[model samples]
Target: MMEIRMILGLFLMITAASGWNVTFESPTVTVHMHETLSVAFTAIVTEADVANGTVVVSTTRESVASVDDLPVLDSSTVNDLVWSSNLVVSGNFLGNADILLSIVSPDQENKTSDALSVIVIREERIIDTLFTVFVAVMVSIMYINFGAAMDWPLCKRTLKRPIGPTIGFVCQFVWMPLLSYGIGLVLFPDDPELRLGMFFAGVSPAGGASNIWTVILGGNLNLSVTMTTISTLAAFGMMPLWIFTLGSTIFNSANLGVPYSRIAMFAVGLVIPLGIGFLIQKKLPRVSRILVRILKPLCSLLIIAIIVFAIITNLYLFQLFSWRIIVAGIGLPWLGYLFGYLLALVLRQPGPDITAISVETGVQNTGISIFLLRFSLPQPAADLTTIAPVSVAIMTPIPLTILWIVKLIMDRRKKSIAASAEKLQGSTEPIPTVSASTKTDNTENP
Candidate 1:
């Protein structure tokens, strides 16, 4: 019979000032989806607490927690509130969410609640599970199609080439993740989810489009395919390991709700499609080519649709940011590009190898990133987490697309010039050679 709000509580503390002190009389709260919940707390103010103050509340994720019946503060007293599901989480949220409570003064001085955590538990939704499974299946097919176009002969040829994969693996697994972590510190030092989001972006495998871009950019297709395979396979081991390792260091171990098991399952799942593609290539080249042609366009359409769906569903989260996070958000991918290309160049690799490694390094598996972020983590975080990868997904392709276009133009111009020169030579008339007798007669006449 009252207002409903969605609550995702990820606590962010605004450290206390010498002023007023506020504490939750009851440190922990538990609530359910439909029923109402209540919380009790007390606050005290002294002359030392100089400024007017209000309670600050936030969920761990992007959205604010939905609390109803908030009490008015008097310098020293107990207050109570009955919480109802907010419009956002009214029927959708599940899991234990930590609700951050802080007192914000006029001057921005604040104090955090010593203890407050909300654990909202719900059963798994069948619809959500089905949708996730559908997406996983689609991803498998997309990778299979990706593998179909792979130049196997070239893959074998480059299999022994140590330099290219060395450069690529270093950039993909080592450099980008480290850079993402650093940027997360600079930009979202206070926000664990944002920082973790960046870390995941770094750890995501190179997308299907990386191989596509490599071919378009006149890079070695063999190396591109090889790198994608290696990284995809490596992700099974690395993604979960990185999530566990980085989760502890970057955020207080409490804040990170990493679905390590889910990540491992998904990473391992990729091998199925990869092996299928290998079989197709080995058994029937003609069918593989047809599947590649068909799947390429189809997979692209599916990817675009999925991206659009994710953005639209979580558009509100993206709106709640200043240009600071946006720049920090978008900056990660560009940094990957600059650093990857430079790393490859520094290794003294050939031009084609450099281009292939650079593209593979910069372009992450945005589809998988979006999917995992959406389904793996709890809500609000999932929505907020997609921002960096979505930005990367949109921005990373521009350079490769432009390079491909420029290469096409240059190739056409070269062909035109060569044809022109050939035509001119063919059209030229040879100078008539003067016979010896004719030359002698002409000299005598003169």
Candidate 2:
């Protein structure tokens, strides 16, 4: 019966894919004239009974524009894939346009792969590019600002304290990932995109922002820094392993099979950059400092740009499925944090330690998840693309917000305690006194 049900499900999916329906990972994109855009397309083949399959993709300007006015752009096909010939658009085609991509398989009677639609808007506004750059800068700034403090000799000494480094490492690698898995399981059981996002979050090591959180929470800053370093290094291996394992499981459950090579590619993309950065940092401290500074801001800008692009592209998804997604996004992070804090508490750790663990466990690497979804999954890339940003936008802010709230409360408490102590000190001070002889004379004479 189970096997039969699985067969039925597969049949239904194939049926859904064969029609002339339009699907887009991102419905709209903002681009400048001469700017290049890349879009992914898929064709699902259902029936084994047909022949002569071919797919054609074309774009039509919204206006009744002339072919000459449409700009003489070129297109190319690579293995069943079609893409814009150049990364840059040289045409004057501006405003909204419909990009039509079709797949026709000769041997198959029905082909039902979900088609991804990408829009090309021609303009010279540098907003998205600038935003991407800004995100990168912010990320670099975070790393440098926090990373410098970790270099101090005293910080190194403090890191060697009893179980400090061990605990920190555990929080960075083991506890946080496990906690993220638990959160994903609970909050996004039905949504593959959300689940994948959570899985990515679980696998990602704490970035530099963690160091700041540790200091603010009164945990050993040195320990946090050390943990972040170790985790970031270990991520080259662990991140891929965790993603492959968890992603395979999640995709399998969702009837999508992910290939091992795809997983390898993702790991390589992530780790190579990280490894290069680490090597530069180790080999040339001065150069590394400069790179880190540049990269931090660049990373921040990239993150924001990616997020904005994602949101803009999937505007329809957000509008259509707003309530369900919003709830999952808001609830999942909180649940993750709660679990992390509980885990820390159970271990009998300090409040700051607990806070660190909570944030690390709850905050995930949404970017990595997006990459995997875009490149690795067997399902239509468009679905993954749309889902990726939605999931990240929903999940990323949760931990950051929670951490901020925790910081505020901690700050207020510290101030209140200081004020109370000052008041007590003032009340208990001794009054001024006259000399002993003067006092005695006054008393006796009187």
Candidate 3:
């Protein structure tokens, strides 16, 4: 237990150091057209042994100038820092423009800080607002389905089986990501955007709500909890390595740009929410339960809302490249579940184990994917944001539907066997026949 706690603590620290504590000094700014503006930003470090870190800062200013138009007047680095770049903003400068800054440290593996930003006043429209709504809707549906499943007595029963939960956790955190990456190679061979999307999905640890899913599926709750804890802790390092290694290998093969800082940010977003959830679960189980009940639905709704909004916002992109994105989107999640189940079967796991593994393997941390898509990809901001959520949105309903079908089939089979046994026993029993002749004979004899 002490070792586990230590490991967990280490995991949190790594995640916090690598992924969290990213903030913009001024997220929003206003400046006049044709005026040179400068903004100061800071990257605050909060962890130890950070080795080297990089920061990418960007702004939206299509109306005023292209990114090249904004150039850094002066740049300097201090405290074990080796590299820094001054951004030149270019293009039409009418409304809003973005300035980007990147920082890299060579030898430090601890907490570090940097500051950079640019000045330009452009009208900012709420982009992907509708998509946000769609994400919400999908999150809601998932929560409802999950909540209903939790009401089943079999849920608890299934969870009590040890092998099931253990296998489930292993498959989810360890195997599923590998499978997703392999599949991405086949499906999006030449497309960096799609490949990265798939890879990101694979690397993210299972969401906190997976514990709830385990309970719903009747897998051992303690095992699920343990797995969730362990996997999340493991994800701190695993996610970064996966993103860096796989992203570079695959995206480089395709000549697609992979942004490291953005990926780090994505990891941070996932880890923070998850860490908070774990802390809550540990410190206050009852409160955590209530929050889960509330947040699960909210997450489902948010996911659905994001999907619908993506469709609408990117209607043009979809119209042009619908087949490519659609096929990959639909295929990835199903593939995830399929491979997950296959792995469990190969391991000779029991039914409950199979179910737990299936859920864990099939569900990717879509939220992380969204953050990556929005921030990291080389594509236009609108295009990447519009398409990223499709991966999760398209895939979310599938496993739930399949699980429901499996449950129904299993239940019917169980009932039929029970009924058949009862019928056979009744048939074997001798029936006592009270014949009229017997009564008459008895009376006469008497």
Candidate 4:
């Protein structure tokens, strides 16, 4: 009985927090221009004492649309349907518009329902199962590999700088979380799943895989490992906090179920493989090198597979992503890279720490994002929002790969020049002098 009451109280809090106003049967009504659609509104007569003496309907903007008939209260419903109203958005509107219904009583009592947004445009099919599956598989493999790739010895870096972890924590918790929500609002405003996805993605720890990139990019691997460890360890508390904070403050949907089980599973996923990898590294360094080399390439292939399978699964949608999503994909990593470098510079960080932070900031574990999207959210929400993290994953490795290739090429050239100079010096021949005609003016020719 006590547990039941507690559950009931929690339910009540959720209901109260879910934005209750004059109840509309549907908060969103879509109709084409010059077409008509009816919306039903209701109120509780006992609680609100709501009545309908006259009905007035108004659109948010002038000359765009109109509504008709305020609903009346129904006493028949003991606990529900205390009152009702009917309104219509006339086909006069062509763009998105909001509508409000006003019920005025004989005693001069006026009650208004919350604004019901009428989308004045046609809606289309948004997602397919094939694309969603491709996304899930791709992200899952990468995360699994991240766990398996861990070398315990390689995981910790000796850092001369004391505050790198703190700086990374601030950026992960503060800058990125806010940026993610703002980005979500702009790119996928109508998608609640996306809002949740972006928020969680931001709050999630720096990717373990980023340490791989930091080593390649000439960043401080020790700093990278330390920051990654710090951020990831901190995630248990930080993720839920950001999710609830961002959700309640922005979307008014604190009632969205937090996937505590999934979060626990994710934590397990991170720890176990890394723990196993550490054992292998300690016992068999030779085996560890071979495994890391193999895992690195395998992870790269997984990234490519994600893109290829995504494109093949829904070729039409892949090519037809709205401009906003495309920009989001390419732009997010770029922002992380830029801001991270600048912040590190301000902190007077060593070169390795700067590179590590920049990469870590840009690279998030898509696995965590995918896990939340797959299990935490309901259908269609998961499918639609998976794109955000997939985008992050896709962009994360690209710049690093390009930079690595460039570094290799430059190193090869430097080595070639050094080798040629050495060969010339060891030729055991007299050194070549200036040509006789060219040097006559400046040299004493013997």
Models, CA RMSD each: 7.3, 12.3, 17.8, 11.4
How close to the true structure is residue 99 of candidate 2, measured as C-alpha lDDT?
A: 43
Show model 2 residue runs off by greater than 4 Å. 1-194, 290-302, 320-324, 378-382, 385-436, 439-446
Q: How does candidate 3 score on lDDT? A: 0.54
- Model 1 CA deviation exceeding 4 Å by range: 1-134, 146-153, 251-254, 275-289, 292-302, 412-435, 441-446
Tell me the tens digit of each residue's lDDT in model 4 across 17-83: 2223467878877776567888776654534343334444545543345554334444443256355
User: What lDDT does the true structure give each of the candidates?
Assistant: 0.66, 0.51, 0.54, 0.62
Better of 2 and 4 by lDDT: 4
Candidate 2 lDDT: 0.51
Worst 10 residues of 4 by lDDT: 11-20
Q: Which window of ten consecutive residues has the lowest lDDT sum in model 3? A: 69-78
Backbone N/Cα/C clashes per model: 16, 40, 69, 9
Per-residue lDDT over 70-106 for candidate 3, one digit per residue giving the tens place of the 0 to 100 score: 2222224323422223333433332233343333345
User: Model 3 Cα displacement at 283 (Å)?
Assistant: 6.0
For candidate 2, which ten residues in a row score worst on lDDT? 64-73
Model 4 — TM-score against the truth? 0.58
Q: What tens-digit string does per-residue lDDT give for candidate 1 at 1-446?
A: 12221121122353444333445545555555444465655455433332365655555532233544444545334323222111122212333455555555665546655535665533346654655666677777787876676665666777787789878888888887788888878887776667767777788887767777777888877788788877877777777777778755864632655576777776777777878887888799998989867754665666766666656655545654567566765676677777878988988888888888888888887777777776677754555566766666666767667778899999999999999999999999999898999999999999
Q: Supply the global lDDT for candidate 4.
A: 0.62
